[model samples]
Target: MEIRWLEAFVAVAEELHFGRAAARLRLAQSPLSQTIRKLEKELGTTLFDRSTRSVALTPAGHAFLPHAHRVFEELELGRQATRATAGVVYGTVSIGFSGALNHLTLPPLTRAVRQRYPEVQLSLTGRVMTGDGVEQLEQGGLDIAFVGLPIDPSPVRTRLIGREPLGAALPIDHPLARESAIDLADLADEGFITTPAAAGSALQELATQACVKAGFRPRVVQEITDPYMILTLVSAGVGVALMSSGVAGIMPSSATFVPLRGEPTYMDHALAWLDDNPSPVLKAVLALAEEVLPTPER
Candidate 1:
């Protein structure tokens, strides 16, 4: 019915907790609960199953979630198109990016903006990890960011641009480097190099989870923010590192990237910005990115 109703529904569905969802929306728990009740009555179906201990999405909620997302996406597109037609496209947009994206997604997007929207200037900050990037967007310090995916959606709007399976970066002389592919369980005892947990690296999370699934926790020997430095450490035989398969092209000569066998671990790349950001320059860049940076085929 109302946009607020959809907003409450989506938030509650994502969090699966009324209190957390209310906190995320900056609304009182009572009001949020009422909104959901009103929405359910209007739709003639229950959206969530609530109990004293836990909350779960009902079948109807699961079916309606994607449609709610599409409604917001279409509304955003309409606003961007209207602004573009108004020709208010000249302004500076600040961008933040993690080290992993510097060589992958950032270059082409920046180049396209430079060529097409020369009147618009970009101020860029490098080596900002996903958590930091999301914070910057919420704080209005960054107009947009290239960040790792699966971040909290409550803070910013995001569009997924790329994804790839993670692989191991090992010293060329390492025994596993000689194999075409190795099981992740094989490296359980080996020390690993990864980005800092505080940096909010999606790769670090995914790799750790993969290792756990393979029946062992990764023994992290070092933490580095820069993906290149992580690879360099691997080359030096300091510790093995888990990296995106897409980054193999940039690997150092002393390091070899080996794909992980069995269940795959993937890293998703995305562009994020505050949904309320009204900069026409940001709108123009987003439009251009839509045209130039379509998700790569697997």
Candidate 2:
């Protein structure tokens, strides 16, 4: 079918609302509805189940969505290849990074890319948790991402970039805060603060797993997304938190970070990208990342 038809289909599929999809595409609602109908007829299958109340994708639509995204990705790749033939490496590489990498890794990597490829543009989105970054990479929204490790290995390729011990954040006046290193079992009865489970935080998983191995389940008192907020809550004596030792640099004055003893717990950091992505610009960036920021040895 026509490219416009696929565009209309993707917009409606993502928005799931005829009016909003039409507005997003800058088309009249009536025409947008007609376009969907035409696309459905051409494909010989219904894509969405619609009612006055809501819109939902049919099974066929679910299966077709990823392919639809691939079409646009391929088109962009072709355009980049054409530019490359003219001796110019140019394209926007969208990158997503979690807050953990904000202090050390991301800044250097970004500067290297800009300096090496002046014509290439880097689109950066920060505070993107691990789970969201993976979803964005799968959907073609991000070309590369710095994500937490111990993730599923399929669909995406990853390389270890950094590793650091996991530690505890406690109120400065807390009894355990005076110790050189604290054991997970020592804090078993203490209320804990952590990132949301739904956000797919590997750090959260690691902390929970460590506590489980220590014999008792941690009683979570609060869930937060920001590292600063988590530390702030800890400083207020809301609860203790398990965090990367790197966070010690930014630790609030009222809070203290102590290494986990008994068991050496650590958080692994990695760079991830889709294996099937054909963007030449992405390839260039990945190469630059390798040279500028070499993967740390395990």
Candidate 3:
């Protein structure tokens, strides 16, 4: 039976009088009586014994009253849950990123989101991938991604939330490290620590391209996967690699970071999500990412 029928049955059962039940339900007496009859008809049993003067629950009405109460409670809960999910409350947002994730000021951004949308549970994952983290977002596995931007994406929406300039991760005492500002050309003959090209790391590709623009194809002395490993290699004098300016934050004490000129550097690093209807939590996280991530001086 319909929710209205159940409500009328409960109201009439509680009041035990036609006029009083109608008043409690904000319905007229005749309609209230008709509603109770429909519920009884649907159930093929008399739920209430009604006379011209008073109303009383039959055996079936007594049996059904508790069930009717529970049904209305469930409907109320469903409406509340709908409202929560329709907005930003009570959701778990999954975010993905690449190597420069830590460099994008995400920890602070995440903290802000936690404080503001406390009900929106956050799950953050970092993967070193060969593709723009956009693909996972498209497949509904990720709500947003932080990665190098100005990326040519395949049917995804991207915001360039940060800009990390090119810097060198070099041993502090290395001859080139002494330069106040290094040019890409200065490192043309230097050995390089490279990441695997097969993993679709755009940042690694950008570093190699910077070397090419500076007049030398880098000699890859090591192929390491992690950004931490990249810095370690540089500190040990295995090679000097072009890196995000924020690399300085995680660099070893033995290494130095210097701004590079003519570096073919990237100014737009990205936060990306699917082009489909996105969740409000994703939107909030994007706003926080945009707020915290810094841009280059253009």
Question: Largest TM-score belongs to which candidate?
Answer: 2
Q: When superposed on Cα atoms, how far off is each prediction in RMSD?
A: 12.2, 3.7, 15.7
Error of 1 at 183 (Å): 0.5
Better of 1 and 3 by TM-score: 1
10 residues in a row with least lDDT, candidate 3: 97-106
Poorest 10 consecutive residues by lDDT, candidate 2: 98-107
Q: Can you write out model 2's per-residue Cα lDDT over 109-223, one digit (the tens) per residue?
A: 8899888889998898877778878889998789998888978666988888889888899999999898998778999889999988898888889889889989989999999
TM-score attained by model 1: 0.70
Q: Residue-wise lDDT of candidate 3 within 187-261, one digit each (tens)?
A: 777888876777667777888777777778888888876777788878888888777787777788888888876
Which of the two, 2 or 3, has more TM-score?
2
Give residue 264's lDDT in candidate 3 (0 to 100): 44
Error of 1 at 23 (Å): 46
Q: If both were scored by lDDT, which would come out higher, candidate 1 or candidate 3?
A: 1
Model 2 spans with C-alpha error above 4 angstroms: 8-67, 118-141, 153-155, 178-180, 197-200, 212-216, 261-263
Q: List lDDT for all candidates, in order.
A: 0.87, 0.88, 0.73
- TM-score list, all predictions: 0.70, 0.78, 0.66
